[model samples]
Target: MRDAKTLFDRLGGKDSIEAVVTEFYHRMLADESVAHHFEDTDIAAQRAHQTQFLSAVAGGPVEYSGSDMETAHKGMGITDAEFDATADHLDAALREFDVPKKERTDVLAAVASYREDIVEADSTDN
Candidate 1:
């Protein structure tokens, strides 16, 4: 039996990953529910960080250089609905890139696994 190809490989490697990441951020920035999160952020830096982050998560050669998910999102008051909306943008981006269903499912699942770390509801504040 042979080992399955890594998602990175299935995703058409670095150049394709960069394209996906770029388009993903464009979609994200256009999504009102999540666009606020990147309001003051540098799009170039965010794209670079996210490209590396996705590359690492997809089992590529690069390691993610960003802060840990929880530390990075702390106090941001992200909610479950916002998270789902963000994922929806990512899904649309992948579809725009013509990514196959199985690979997109894997990518979405990997990102969704971090929901606990990324979502921080501020119930007490309200």
Candidate 2:
């Protein structure tokens, strides 16, 4: 299996990642619903953290020893609808970056793999 670093390198590494992320956030912030979540937060720090997180996830040299996703997002009050909209923004960014469809799928799959860790449902009993 190709490691994330190798795959990321093929996708153009940090520069490309930053480009996509910037575009993703730009689009996200423009959307009223998504913007609300970030209203009180420092978007700069959020952007930096996201970059570091993605770098580590992509197997780059960066180390993201940050808080676990669940804890980090636990009280954010993020609904499934919000999550999906964020994902759509990401997809749009990838498309704008001209990422190949297969690569886009792989990246999105990686993002999806973290769903359980990032999402908090109202009831675990369901």
Candidate 3:
């Protein structure tokens, strides 16, 4: 049995979530390995969706209206290495926002749980 406080609450609620997600975009944009994925994308909208999605998953009141992970990542040709690199940025973002160690680890672990849903198979491998 876990404590009653939600990750969202421990994370300082909606405002903190927005701030962290914004910082996450900053980290992602500066990363050469994953920057291209966002080149033509609408960043504001993307961040909004991300904030909402992260909120929903973290036990907040917002509902996420974004595309499913597989569909959203389709044709992106995302590799495992790139995905891991992106996850690293996420961890850094959470740390930069001063999320607790256990919460940060748990957050990334939850994100990593979607590895298969987000990673596309490389056709060139075969």
Candidate 4:
């Protein structure tokens, strides 16, 4: 099986990852529902971390030592619908970057594999 690093390198490494993420966030910020989720976030920092995380997952040179996925997304009250929207946005961004369809599928698959780690029920006791 191809490792994360090999896949990432084949996909153009850090520069490609950064471009895709920047595009993704730009789309997110333009969408009202997505924008609301990031209202309290430092978008610059979030973008940086996203790039790092993707880089590591794609098998680039970076090691993502950031918070665990659940903790990172916790307390955001993200619903299943919102998660689907976010994933769709990411897919759009990848397409905009002209990523080949097969490569896009691979990348999306890598991302989907992490869904359980990043999503949880709303913690409020309501």
lDDT for each residue of candidate 3 in 1-126, tens digit (9 for 90 to 100): 766988778888889988988999999999887899999999999998988888888878788788888888988888888888888888888999888899898778878888898989553442
True-structure lDDT of candidate 3: 0.86
Models sorted by lDDT, best on top? 1, 3, 4, 2
The residue ranges of model 3 lying beyond 4 angstroms of the native Cα positions read: 1-3, 122-126
- Among all windows of ten consecutive residues in candidate 3, which has the lowest summed lDDT? 117-126
TM-score for each candidate, following the candidate numbering: 0.92, 0.86, 0.91, 0.87
* Clashes by residue pair, model 3: none
| Number of the top TM-score candidate | 1
Better of 1 and 4 by lDDT: 1
Candidate order by TM-score, highest to lowest? Answer: 1, 3, 4, 2
Q: What is the lDDT of candidate 4?
A: 0.82
Please write out the lDDT profile of model 2 over residues 1-126, one tens digit for every residue.
Answer: 754446577668888888888888899899997798788888878888887777677667788988988888887766677777888898899899898898787777877887877767543322
How well is each residue in 35-122 modelled by candidate 1, as lDDT tens digits? 8999899999888888898889999989887899999999899988888888888888889999999999999999999999998984
What lDDT score goes with residue 51 in model 2? Answer: 76
Model 4 per-residue lDDT tens digits across residues 1-126: 754447687678888989999999999999986689888889989999999998888777799989978888887767666677788898899999888888788878888887777656543422
**Residue pairs in steric clash, candidate 2?**
none
- Candidate 4: worst 10 consecutive residues by lDDT? 117-126
